[model samples]
Target: MTEQHDEPRSGTSSPAAASPALARLVGMPAPDFAEHVWSRAPLLTRGSDLPRDFADLFGPDAVDELVARRALRTPFARMAKDGTTLADRTFTLGGGVGAGIGDQLSEDRVLRELAGGATLVLQALHRSWAPVQDFAAALADDLGHPVQVNAYVTPPQNQGFSDHYDVHDVFVLQVAGEKRWRIRPPVLEAPLRDQPWERHRAAVEQAAQSEPFLEETLRPGDCLYLPRGWLHSATALGGTSIHLTIGVHAWTRRHLVDAVLGRIGARLSADVEARRSLPVDPGRSSGSEVAFGEDAEVVRSLVAKALHDLSVGEVVEALRPQVRAAQRAEPLGVLDQVERATHDEQGGTTWRVRRHLAAHWEDAGDSPVLVSRVGRLEVSADDRDAVAEVLDGIRDAGDLDPRLRRRLALAGLLVPADVSGE
Candidate 1:
C-alpha cells in the first residue's frame, strides 16, 4: 500500500527532498508506489484533495473563457468530434480587432461543436497559464522529470480520443464533472516513445473486447494513475467532464547509460590508437563478412579501454548540470541586477537562488564553476564560498560578494528574495 509522509522538513533544498516525489500526486509515498504500482498496474484513488489543489486550473468556465476570449490560435487549442480531430479552421477565424493578425478561437463555432458532442482540448497550458506553469514547475522539480499538462473539456456522454495508450505515464486529475474510463492492460508493456498504440491496432482492439484492467467513473477530486502503454478511453457521464493530464516524461537508466557512453566516446576518440585506420586487405573477401583476427582484438581492446576510462560518478555529475539547465529560470532585470551587484554592497536587499534550480557547484575541473538552470558561472577559489553561501538559501545582499551576486543574478541564477516568489 502507498503511504504518504508528512510534508518535507522545513527548508528542504528541493521539493523532492522528502523521499520519492510521486507520492505528492498520489496519496501513497514514493517508495511504495514505485515498488507496488509503478510501471506495473493501474491505480484509482477516489475523494482526493486534488480538486481543491487545482481548483483554479481548468473547468467548464475556464473552457468557455479560453475559447471565447483568449484569442488562441492553432495547436494551442483544438477540437475533436467522435474520436476524429477536427480542422482548426472549423473552430477558428481571423481576429476581429486587427487585420491580418492571425487565426483565433471562434466562440460561436466552438460552442456549436461542443453542443454537437465535440471535446475541446487545451494543449500545453503550462506555457499559457501562470498557475499551471508554477504547478508544473514544482512537480517537475519534485519528480526529477520533465512534466507537461493538457486539459480536456468533454460534453456529457462524449469522449475525446478513442482507446489509445500514451507513450508517457500520466496522472489524470478529475478537476470537474465525472467520466467513465475503460482501461485495459498494455498491448506492449512499458512501451518506448516510438511504440504508439497505432502500431498494435488490431491487438489493442482485440484486447479491448475482453475484461479491462479497470472500469470506473472518476468524479471530481478523484485521480487515476496509468503507466505508459496502458490502453484507455473515457467518456463524460451525466455532465460535462474536465480533467488535467499531467504527463511525466521519466528519464531512464538507458538515458544515463547513454550519457556515460557519450562521455566515454569522447575520451576514446581523443586516443591516437583508437583513431587508427582499420585494416582493409585487398585480398580479403567483401562478400558477407570479414575475417576476425587482429582487427577483432583491436576492436575489443578499444572497447575495453573505453570502459576502463569511463567513470559513472563523473558522467552523472556532468549530467546534473545539463539537466538543471533544461529548466527555465526567472531572471532579475539586467539593469537592476548590475546596479545592485556593482553599487549595493550595503543595501538591505536579500537574494536567493531561484527556486527549483538544480544548482550544482563543480569544483573538480580546472575551472571551478557554479552551474544552474539559469546558466553556468566560472569562479575563482576565493569566490567559491560566497557562491556556495548564496546558493544555500536566502541571504542578505551585503553578506555576499556583490560582484558575484550581480553576475549570478544577471545570469538569471539568482533573484531578489522579495520578487523571486512572483
Candidate 2:
C-alpha cells in the first residue's frame, strides 16, 4: 500500500480550508508526489497560513556561529540616491569570485541577510539540517524525487536577485516577511542543465522586447510556484524578510529515454549482436558484391527494440523505484551494528558492519533482503524467502551465534563490534 504524508506548511501550501480549485493546483499527483506543471508559468496564491517561529528552524545561533567562524560569504549593500549601492564584501567559502558590484557576496551571506530582513522567505540552511530535512521529506512525498531546499532572504527596498530564472521547478514560501515579485510568463519551457542563468537572461531579454510582467507583493504565508524557465525578480518591501525556495529537480521524457538506451547498451555487450564481426572486402566492392552479415541485422534489431522500450516508457517506470529508494535512504555511520548469521549448534553470530545504504530503497525488488529504517526484514515474492528469514533472525551486537557469525564476518556482513575483542 502506498503511504501518503501530510504536506508540511514550510514546504507546501497548508490544507486549512483552501478553495477546491487551489487545492487541486497545489496537490502533488500520485504513484509519486510529482506535479504535472511541465512547461508552465508561475502560479501565485495568498492566504497560505505558514508556520511562525520559522526563523528558529535555521537556528540563529548556528547562523551566528557560521558567520563568526567566517564559514560564509558576506556582501553588504546600502540604499543610495541612485539605487542600491554595494558596500564591503568577502568570500569565506570556496565559491569562485567575480567583480560585479554585488557578485562578490557569498550565497550564505545573501541568504542570511535576506532572512534577517524579510519575513516572506523561508531559510533552509542545508539538506542535513533537521527542519530542512523534514521539509524536504514532505516535498519528496509530493514530488516523488528527492527535493532540495535553497534559502533566500530579501531586505526591504532591496532587490534579492537580479532578473533571472531557475532550472528547476520552485515553490517559494513566504515565511515571515513581505517581498515584491515580478515574474514573466514562461518561455523556452522546460530548459535544463547548469546554464539556467544564461538561458534566463536570454529569455528575459527576449521578453523585454515585448511587454514585461509587472511586480506583485507577497505577504507572510503566501506561496508562488514557478515552473522552469519563468524569469522573475524579487525585492524586499520595508522590513526584514525571509523565505524558503524549495526546488524540485526536473525529470524529462528525453532523460528517461537516454537511461533506457544506456541499460540496453549494457545488456547488448553479452549477446551475439555485440560479438559479430564486421564485413570487409580487400577490394572495393561494387553494390552487387556487398553482403550485410546476419550479425549486422541482429544489432539493428536490438537497437530498434531498445528504442521501442524507450517509446513505451518502460525505462522510465523501471527507474521510478530506484529513484524512490534513493529518496528514502538514510546515511550510515560506524556505530551501527547488525547480526548476520545464525548457528543453531550455538546461538547466533553478531558482528558490526559498516556500509552506506543506498539512498533509495522503498521498493523490495530494488535490493536483496536487507535491514532498513522501516524495520528489520521486508520480504516479497521475488526474494528468496529462506535466505531473508535467516538474515532477519540475526540482530544486534551480542545476539549472533559464534560459528555463523564468523562466516558472516568473512562475507563482510558482520565484523567484531569491539576492536580489542579476541
Candidate 3:
C-alpha cells in the first residue's frame, strides 16, 4: 500500500512561513552562527540547547516508511555494511503485476538487510520527503546557498562507512536513537567539489589514528555541524539510529574564480587573436616541437585584457543558471496555482516567490523587463516595485495590484504564499 506523509510536528513555526530555519536549527542566533561557526569550525549543540527536538524534521518512522512503503527506486536509497556499500541487486527487484519498472527497492530485501545490520541510506530526502523538503528549502533560502539532504539509518552497534570527510559542509542532525560521532580537523580545509576525501585516503587514514577533536554520543535533538573537509565518523550506540545529514554546498572563492575565468574565456572567444591558429610550421622551430612561446605570450596578454574588461554583472549572470539548477524550492500545484491566480485577480491573498525565484531588472525595448528563472517579464514602470516586493519575499499582498499579481503568477515567477500566522 502507498503511504502518504503529511506535515510531521515540524517543531516551531514552519520555516517557509514564519522565520529563518537556520536560527532554529543551529541553536544559536543567526548572526553569531554566521560569524563564529559557519564554515570556520565545528559546532555540537544538544537538543535542549535547540528550540526543540528535530522530531519535526524526520524520525524512525520516516526511515521505515521511505525504505518499505514508498516504492522507492534505486539510487534514491542504498545500504552499506562495515564501511562498504552493499550491491544494489541484493536489495532490489522489479515491481510485479501493475508496476512495470525494474530496479525498485524491494521492501522485503530492505527488511532483510536491516535485520542483518546494514545501514540504510536515503539519499536526496530534500526532494522526496515532505517535512525535510520544506525545512531544506528554507535553509537554502536562509544560507543563500544550495542544500541537499540524506538520511542515514544504522543498526545498533554497527558503523556504516569508514572515517572520511565530505567536500561540502554538513549538519548532522540526530533525529532518533543514539549515534556517537567523532570529529577531527580536515587534512584539506574547506575542500571544493573536485576534492573528494578518496583523493586523500592516505592522509585521512593516518589522521584517524590521532586523538579526535570531539567524541560524543548524540541523542535525539542533538546537532553537530562539520565544515567541508572536516573528518568525521559515527556508529549506532545500541538500538537503531536515524539521522538527517543536511549538506550545504556553500559558495566559495573558487566558484567565483571559475565564473570569472569562464567569462574571460567567453570574452576571448569572440576575439580573432584568440582563435588564430598556432604556428603551422613546427619544423622551423629549434626542436621541431610546436613552439608555443610566442603564442603563450599573446594568449596571456589577451586573458589579462579580458579579465580587466570582464564585468561583475556578466559573471553573476553567467552563474545564475548553474545556481538555479543545483537548488530548488517547493514544487507548485499548477491547477490550484492557476485557480488561485484566477481567484486572487483582485489581490486579496498574499503571494510569494515561485520556487523562491531570483531575478534582476533589465531595460528591454518595450519598457523594463524583470529577468527571472521563468523568463523575462515586461512590467510597466509603476508596477515594477510591487513585483520586486513579491520577489523579495515580502509578506504584504493585501494591497498589491490584482492584474500585476495575476501576471506574475501566470509567468511562473510568483505563487500564493500562505503566511497567515507570520
Candidate 4:
C-alpha cells in the first residue's frame, strides 16, 4: 500500500556515491554476479565476506529518527504480527489543530505495538530516508532497473509475514541482530507483477513444508539475494532484528511484449476497419456458434497482422514513458539551486547532472529539447555543448550561459553538486 503522497516528493541534496556500488554490496565483482547469479539463483554473502558493511546506509538508529522524530504517517509505516496486519488506527491519531488531519502517526502507540512483538515496517525508505535513498539510487543505476528499500524491525522471536514470494528480486541486508530465513525455489518461475504468491497459496503452503533450499541465521552485516518468485520466511532471533530489503523491479520479456502489443493497439486505433463494430449475432445471444469459430478468428487475425507489422522502434517508443516513471530523477534543493543559477559571477560554483534525471536530447529542427519526467525544456542551439557537459558530470556554474544555467536549475535537470543533507 504505497501512497502517492509519500513518494519521492522532496528532492534529496546528497547524490549517491558513484563507486562500483554493486561490487561493494555483494562482495564480488559486479560482473561475476550479473553473469552467474542475478535472476538465476540465490547467493549468500556473510558480513566478513565483503569489503564493507552497510552501516553507512542504515541501522537501528535510523528507525528511531523516522518513527519518533520525523512525524511519519501511514501507509508509509505499518505493523504486522503473526502474519496479520494491525489496523491503522492502532498506531495513528489526530493531526491536531493547524494540521487538520486524522491519520498522523502516534509515537506512543507505535512504541506500545513494538513492545508487544508486532514487527514494524519502514516502507519506501528510498523516498523517506536519506542514506537509504542515496544507496537505492546507486544500486538502481548498477542494476539498470527500478529499486525500492524497505526496513523490517521485528522483536525477538517474532515474524512479520508468512512464507510468500515477491514479484521482484530482492537483496536482504541484515543491518542489526539476527534472523533465521527459510528459503525455497519458486512454485511459479518469474511470476508477473499481477501474479502474487496467494494465487498459488495451496502450492506454496505445501512447498514450504518441504526441505528448504537454504536455511540459515543471518547476523549483522550479512546479506542474501533471492530472485523474483522465490519463497521465503524469516523470524527474528536473540534481542531484535533490523534489516533492509532492497527490491529490484526488473524489466522483463513481459514488459517487452506489453510494449509491442501496446504500440500495435495505438496503431489500430486509427484503423477504420478495426474500429468498426463486430457483426451482430443473428440470434442476439450471449454466445452464438460463430462466436468461437468465425468472429473470434477475424479479431485474432487482425491483431496477428498488426503484431507482425510492428517495428522495434515503435515498441521502444511505447516503453519510454514506463522507463521515465520508474527511474527517479536526482534530488533537488530549491534554495541552493536557485541561488547558484541566479547569482552572477558565480564562477567558482559547481553543479552536476541530476542523478537518474533520465533527461535525453531530442533534435527539434533548430533547437534541441531535454525530455524527461520534468517535461520538455527546449534548449537554445548555442548552449548545447554546455548542457551536454553539465549533464555528463560536475561543471563550473560559470561555464554555462547564464540563461541556460537558470533554465536547467529551475527545470530540475541539475543541482548543487555538493548539497549536504541540510
Candidate 1 residue-wise lDDT at 207: 89
lDDT string for model 2 (176-251, tens) is 6688887776666677765576645666767745554546787765667787777777777777556767777766
Each model's TM-score, in the order given?
0.84, 0.58, 0.87, 0.89
Per-residue lDDT over 271-344 for candidate 4, one digit per residue giving the tens place of the 0 to 100 score? 78688886666664666665656757776888988998998887877888898999677667678777777773
Candidate 4, 152: how far from true, in Å? 0.4
Error of 3 at 400 (Å): 5.3
Please give the RMSD of candidate 4 to the true structure.
Answer: 7.2
Mind sharing the TM-score for model 2?
0.58
Q: Each model's C-alpha lDDT?
A: 0.74, 0.50, 0.80, 0.80
What is the per-residue lDDT of model 1 for residues 1-422, given as tens digits with 9 covering 90 to 100? 12112332121122233643344456555555555666667777654432244566566677777778788887898999777999988888888656445668889888888999999888888777776777777777666778888999899999878888998889888888889999888889888777888899999889889887678888877778888998999999988889999888877676787787788778768888778886677644754345546677776788787888777786887577557755566434677766665655676667766777677777866678776676667888877776777677545444766666667667777666676443
Say which candidate scores most in TM-score. 4
Q: Candidate 3 or 4, higher TM-score?
A: 4
Better of 1 and 2 by lDDT: 1
**lDDT score, residue 373, model 4?**
72
| Alpha carbon lDDT at 71, candidate 2 | 33
Error of 1 at 185 (Å): 0.8
Off by over 4 Å in 4: 1-19, 289-301, 363-367, 381-386, 389-398, 420-422
Q: Write down the TM-score for model 4.
A: 0.89
RMSD in Å for model 1: 5.1
lDDT, model 2: 0.50
lDDT score, residue 365, model 3? 62
